[model samples]
Target: MASSPLKTICIYGAGALGGAIAAKLATGLGEQVTVSVVARGAHLEAIRAQGLRLWEAGADRPLVARMTATDNAAELPPQDLVITGLKGHQLTAAAPGIAGLLHSGTRVAMILNGVPWWYFHRDRQSGHAERQIEELDPNGELWRRIGPERVIGCVAYQGAEVINPGEVELSNNGRFILGEPSGENSVDIEAIATLLREAGVNISISPRIRDEIWSKLMGNAAFNPISALTRALMSDIMQNPALAAMVGDVMNEVKAVAESLGARIAISVEERLERSRQIGPVRTSTLQDLLAGKPLEITPLVGAVVSLAKLTGISTPTSATILALVTQLDRENMRAAE
Candidate 1:
């Protein structure tokens, strides 16, 4: 099949990060590309009424990017690029909807945290050989419906939040690390990078994207759960002696497991923790989800680590305990909401 001209883009889950991307692309592209969002509820309503709004730090006013917004993906035509910003647990349920927005040349970018569902799909060097991550995709719904071949691995380093129904505030303008699973500098990957760069977004293409994924996960697996469990900020977690040490332990375990599975950790545990500490007093996405009464990405962030540890004979005592507690918290909180 011929490569797509790459004009159309659909952001599957237009919450914080997705909203930022959509707003930037739609506004910066200036009719060059057609950008749309799949959003629902009050957020969807707000976007439909007033367009997607974004407020980056230091900006005097928010950026209102006029674009199409829909709750149903089936309503839209086949897209050239589908960027999925959904949480790990949410991806499975949204898989079929995402499929409704694709064509043969469509590429799906998974801009998510922790270990992605398609982590083992085409990376044969891991010796996992297309094995499904049980925690992230237990039913194989995502793998079967979305297909790993369409995935463009992405590691997003930005922090943003939905302050209101349709308004998102960016904490930092971070770049996205994108790659292809086949380890080839394919046309699809470069095209996506070119589009993102043209929109004033920083992007880096890597052959060893799995290494970048592991490097990003090292901080998230520790910080996200801890933030939710303690209601602490990034600065708080880094400054507190007890919490800092605990995250360090979890980082070490994650590093071991990743190295065992053929992923190279980019930095030391101390360096990772220090870098996190340097960030401002910001609430993590997990903590934000907990406060919003939304489902936490526990299974993907922490539970997945424990599962991998058992597989690789890596002892993750700290990670195991944190996973258990957060799992219970998620269950009890959801049960009470009902």
Candidate 2:
């Protein structure tokens, strides 16, 4: 059979992660693939004016790339692949616009953290079959609009930050773990993986994406909130005796919930904390948001886990207590902005 024609790919929410991916696709693959970026505000304006810039340490100059950039989803053609780099809290508001860019065959790869909204969808034994996580999705709007069939679960490890309007500085050259929602194989997902790998992204396919998700969540559920509350880096948070003990409590609770849902996290709490310490001082995304006065992603990151714990009859005292404080902090920050 002949090879399929080149397909169009769009990176919605062209912030740090999406901008880096867009720059790679537009420059790395060039004419082999059509790439578009969806961005807004000053970043979109900057991209339109001078293209996207990537700053790397020890580089002679910044890497620059150009492609179709737009804020309105209606202005762009339907995409064969849409990778959403938006934070968990931004997904619902952007869902309709994302839906507008999808053709019937379009596949959406969600590169985000914490407990996903689709956690209960494919796990029949998780007590809630096909039930939407209201804490994450809020009335099933995203579930009804995007549909789980179009989803490709992902765990993104690469770290990047927007230094300015159109410039992104990559902090880590990490891999993206991709999987289908049903935990099965498909040609469409392979095509997506190939496209990303060709664009210079380290990509891997996982049979149990949820297991990987839970494993990653073990860190997020413990570290992110602690970072935000104490305004401390991962190293300091994990090294502290009291904080480390709290993290252990939170991780155990989250682990029980994950095991109840048939997803096993092999890594021990101490191992996860030790690995984090080895990475040196690192500020989490939740802490960054709190500092920037942006809305914290409470629902998916911490609240959803607590919700799952309750549904499964497991107690998450440490996680719940931290979630309450951080959530209150978020509300106060939002109110102050208003």
lDDT of each: 0.89, 0.85
Residues 168-260, model 2: lDDT tens digits: 887767788998877778888888787778878899998888889989888888888889999998888878999888888888888888988
Tens-digit per-residue lDDT, 1-338, candidate 1: 22337889999999999999999999888878889999999999999999889998779899999898999999899999999888988998898899888888899999989888888877956799798886688788888888999999999999899999999998887889999987789988988998888888889999988898888889899999999999999899889999999999998999998998999876899888778778999999999999999988998788888898899899999999999899898998788777
Runs of candidate 2 with Cα error greater than 4 angstroms are 1-6, 56-60, 124-127
**Measured by TM-score, how close is model 2 to the native structure?**
0.95
Give candidate 1 regions above 4 Å deviation. 1-4
What are the TM-scores, per candidate, against the unseen true structure?
A: 0.97, 0.95
Task: Give the number of the best model, judged by TM-score.
Answer: 1
